[model samples]
Structures are given as structure tokens and as C-alpha cells.
Target: MAAGHYGLSNLIAIVDHNGLQIDGTNEEVMDLHPLDAKWSSFGWHVLMVDGHDHEALLDAYQEAEKQDRPVVLIANTVKGKGVSYMENQVEWHGKAPSDAELVQALKELGGDPS
Candidate 1:
């Protein structure tokens, strides 16, 4: 709100809303629903996008750049996105991958081990 009042049009906030935490889902850990309304109440121009989609992310940024007020991009995503064993799993939130797991995860993401 203060940012808007001070007229900081260049400020851009991107929130990654991947519901998982080390404890559990964000709802189970601590609910922060109505996120859209929350930022709007703070006088920001809010936009939601699929956090995984590069095109969508780029488009959202472009749209945000046009706003006179500060922009808040709320990107909804999956934790540990590309790995089969880690995707949407809260356990992986703070866990480091084993060597085998790293290989598998990289394979799933189509990245060369070299």
C-alpha cells in the first residue's frame, strides 16, 4: 500500500505459490487463501499465472509492465516440478537429492548428465 501511495510503478512482485512446505501443504501448515484479494487490498495490480509455463510467465510480465501501479504476479506452481518422485511432495521441500535421485530427476527433465 505504501508502495502504491509513493507511486512505485517499477516494483514487480512475483510470488511462487507451490503449496508445499517441509511440514506439509500450506493449507495444513497455515492457510493464506484469497491471495488475490490480499494483494489488491494492498493497492497492487495483481495477476495470476501458471508458474510452470514459460510463455504464460512471459506474457504475465509483459502485462504487468503496462500497469501504472506496482504489480504482483501470483504464480501457482508444483513443488519439485520436473521430478517424478519429488513433484508436489512436501518431503522434498528441504531435502537434498541422493546421487541416484539426482540422475533420475535430471533424466525426467531431459537434461544430460554430462
Candidate 2:
């Protein structure tokens, strides 16, 4: 709101709307649905896109740069992203990956395990 009033064209708020938090899914915990509409209601240029796609993210940033007022990118993504076991699992929220899990996650991410 303050940014909109002050005309801060450079201000961009990128929200990672993963839908999963510490406890569980956002719908199970506290539903913050209609996210884009909420931001739009506050006079922000909202762009909702798949957060996992690098190209989509770049495109969103480029689109936001063209907007006059403050823009908010609602990035819809999975919580644990590249890790197969941890993806969307709330237990992994605050917990660091175990040694074995780390190996698995790294392998899944295609990173050199060495």
C-alpha cells in the first residue's frame, strides 16, 4: 500500500505460494485462497505463474518491470521442489535432511553426490 502511494515502480514482491507450511497444506492449516485477487484488491499488478519453471520466473520479472505500480508475483510451487521424498511433505519444513536423505535428494536433483 505504501509503495503504491509513493509510486515505487522498482518494488516487486514475489510470494512463493507453495500451499504447504510447517503443519500441513495451506488449505488444511489456514487457507489463503484467491491470493492474486487479494493482491489485486490492494492495487498491485499480480502475476501468478509456476514457480518451478525458470523461464516462467524470468518472464514474470520482465513483465513486472514494465508495470508502473508495485507488482507481486505469486509463484505457485511445491515445498520441497526438486527432492522427491520431501516434496509437499510438511515434516520437512523445519527439519534438515538426514545424511541418507541428503544423498537421495542430491541424486534426485542431479547434483554430483561427491
Candidate 3:
């Protein structure tokens, strides 16, 4: 709000919109739908992009650089993206994976587990 009020065009805020909090999904906790509208109302230039897509992210940032108001990049992503067992599983939020789980996750991601 202060940023917008002051017209801080240099200010850029990136939100990791993974739909999960420390407790539960954003919907189960507190729904903040129309998030882009909320920021826009505050006099920000809002941009939405796929969090996993590097090219999309670069494009959003490049676009943000042209905005006259504060910019907010809402990056929509999947929690624990590539890990089959951890994806969208809130229990994995604060929990560290075991060595075996790490190996499995690495394998699933096509990385050398050695």
C-alpha cells in the first residue's frame, strides 16, 4: 500500500502462489481469490505467470520493468512440483524428507541420486 501510495515504480513484489500455507491449502485457510484485482486496486501493475516456466517468468519481469506503478508478479505453482509423494501434500511443508525419500525424489526428477 505504501509503495503504491508513494508511486514506487521501482518496487517489485513476487508472490509464490502455490495454494498452500504452513497449515493447509489457501482455500481452507483464507481465500484470497481475485488476488490480481486486489493488487490492481492498490495501484499496482499486476502480472500473472506460471511459476515453473522460466521463459514466462522472464517475460513477466521484462513487462514489469515497463510499468509506471508498483509491480506484483503472481507466480502460480504446484507445491513440491516434481516429487510424486510430496506434491500437494501439506504434511511435507515443514517436514524434511528421509535419506530414502530424498533418493526417490531425485530419481523421480531424473537426477543422479549417487
Candidate 4:
């Protein structure tokens, strides 16, 4: 609100919209649906994009640069993306992976486990 009131066109904020928080899913905790509308109501220029797509993210930044007010990029992404076991599992939020889990996760991502 303050940013919009003061017209902070230079400000750019990025939000990782993974739909999960430390406790649980957003819907299970506090529902903040119509997120774009909420931000727009605050007089911000909102850009929605796939969080995993590098090209889409770059494009969003470029678009934000052309806006005349504060801009926010909402990046839609999956929690623990690419790792099957951890993906969207709330327990993974604050827990560190075990040594074996780390190796498996690395393999799943095609990264060298060494």
C-alpha cells in the first residue's frame, strides 16, 4: 500500500507461490485465493509465471521494467520440485534430507551423487 501510494516504480518483488508454508498447504492453513486480485487491489502490477521456467521468469522481469508502479512477480511452483518423494510433502518443509535421501534426490535430479 505504501509503495503504491508513493509510486515506487523502481521496486520489484518476487514471490515464490509454492502454495505451501512451513506448517501446511496454503488452503489447509490460510486461504489466500485470488492472489493476483489481492495484489492488484493494492495498486501493483502483477506478473504471473511458471517458477521453474527460466525463460518465463526473465520475460516477467522484462515486463516489470516497463511498469509505472511497484511490480510483483508471482512464481507458481511445486514444492520440492523434481524430487518424487519430497514433492509437495509438508514434512519436507523444515526437515533436512537424510544422507540416503540426499543421494536419491540427487540421482532423481540427474546430479552426480559424489
Candidate 5:
């Protein structure tokens, strides 16, 4: 695994745990509960946050920077945030948007999906 072998002791990998995998759901694939303990075992300080809140993210980054060791900011994000039919739905995980979909998505994202 790249994680275990890539000198990642000094790295902070913020995995987006939305409870969905490439398949149907995360529970169907693996039981990744008690996730903090798992990553701490890998020598990282974990901090969970609200993935959509800008205020929380800013605070988390500030705290993470103050840490002496690697700090994983595990922000739980939706599959398609700011979208009408997609947020938290696993169907759009790897699918790209069509021209029509892109326009709709942009409007949902304050007319800017950038």
C-alpha cells in the first residue's frame, strides 16, 4: 500500500468518509468504524470535521498546523455537495456531468462549481 510504504508518518491524509465506497455502500465492502483509532495506529493525530462548513474547515486547518506530528483532518463530505439530486447519493461517485447537468450543478453551487 502507498500509505504504509510512502514514508507517510509525517503525512496527514484527510480521507472523505461519506460512508460510501466505489460499490453500493462502505458497510458492504468493509467495516471501517472506529476510524480514528485505525489512523492513530498509523501514527497520525485525527480531527473530524463538518465537511460542508467553511468555518469548521478553517479552524481545523489552523489546529492541524499547530500540531507537531501528522494530523489527519477527516472531513465527512457528501458525494455531490450543492447538487439537487446527488448530494450524499453514491450514484454520482465517479460519473462526469453532461452539458445540461454541468449547468444545473453550477447554478446549485452559487453559479460556480469552480
Candidate 6:
């Protein structure tokens, strides 16, 4: 709100809405929380999309750049995204991944072992 009114047209804010905060599920504390609506209500151009999708991310960014006001991209991300056991699991939030899990996660994100 302040940014838009301040004439910061090029400002952009992207938040990873994985519903997993530091302690517990975001829903548990902020039940039925609508990130998009909240930001849009605050006069921000809001975009919602899967954070894991590269194409969607690119498209959203392009669209945001076209907005005259600040844009808040509410990306639906998965905490510990690529790891099987960590995906969408709140326990993984702020927790360090095991060495094995890190290796697997890197591979999943297309990081070559070499």
C-alpha cells in the first residue's frame, strides 16, 4: 500500500505461500488465509501460481512487470520442495535437511552431481 502510493511502480514482492511457517501450518494459525485476496485488497496487483513451475513463474513475472503499481506474487510453493518426505510437510520448515536428502533434493531441482 505504502509502496504503491509512494510511486514505486517498479517495486515487486514475491512470497512463497507454502502454508508452512516457522512453527506450524499457516492454516492452523491463520485459518483459511487468502494471500491473494489480502494483497489485492491492499491495492497490489496480485498473481497466484505454482512456485515450482518454471514457465508459470516466468509468465507471472512478465505479467507483474506490466502492472503500474507494486505487484505481490503469491507463489504456492512446497517447503523442502523436491524432497519426497519434506514436500508440504511443516516439520521441514526451518529444519536442516539430511545429507542424503540434500543430495536427492539437489538432483530433483536439476542440479547435476558433477
How many pairs of residues in model 2 come into backbone collision? 0
lDDT per residue (tens digit) for residues 1-114 in model 6: 788667466988989878877668877767647677877777788888898899999999899899888898888887876667788787777778778878888888789755
Per-residue lDDT of model 5, residues 1-114, tens digit only: 345445454566678878887777877788798888887787677899988889998998888777666778888887787788788777788889898899889888888655
Worst 10 residues of 2 by lDDT: 1-10
Q: How high is the CA lDDT of each candidate model?
A: 0.90, 0.89, 0.94, 0.94, 0.79, 0.81
Off by over 4 Å in 2: none
Model 6 has an lDDT value of 0.81
TM-scores of all predicted structures? 0.93, 0.93, 0.93, 0.94, 0.82, 0.83
* Displacement of the residue 5 alpha carbon in candidate 1, Å: 3.0
lDDT of 3 by residue, 16-93 (tens): 899998889889899999899999999999999999999999999999999899999999999899999999898888
Candidate 2 per-residue lDDT, tens place, 1-114, comes to 787777788999989888888887889998888888887877789998899899999999999999999999999989998888888888988999888889899999999777
Better of 2 and 6 by TM-score: 2
Clashing pairs in 5: none
Arranged by lDDT, best first: 3, 4, 1, 2, 6, 5
As a TM-score, model 5 comes out at 0.82
- For model 4, residues 1-114, the per-residue Cα lDDT tens digits are 999999999999888899998878899899989999999999999999999999999999999999999999999998999999999888888899999999999999999999
Provide the global lDDT of candidate 2 against the true structure: 0.89
Flag regions of model 5 displaced more than 4 Å.
1-10, 112-114
How high is the lDDT of residue 41 in model 6?
72
User: How well does candidate 5 score on lDDT at residue 94?
Assistant: 89
Residue 81 accuracy (lDDT) in model 6: 69
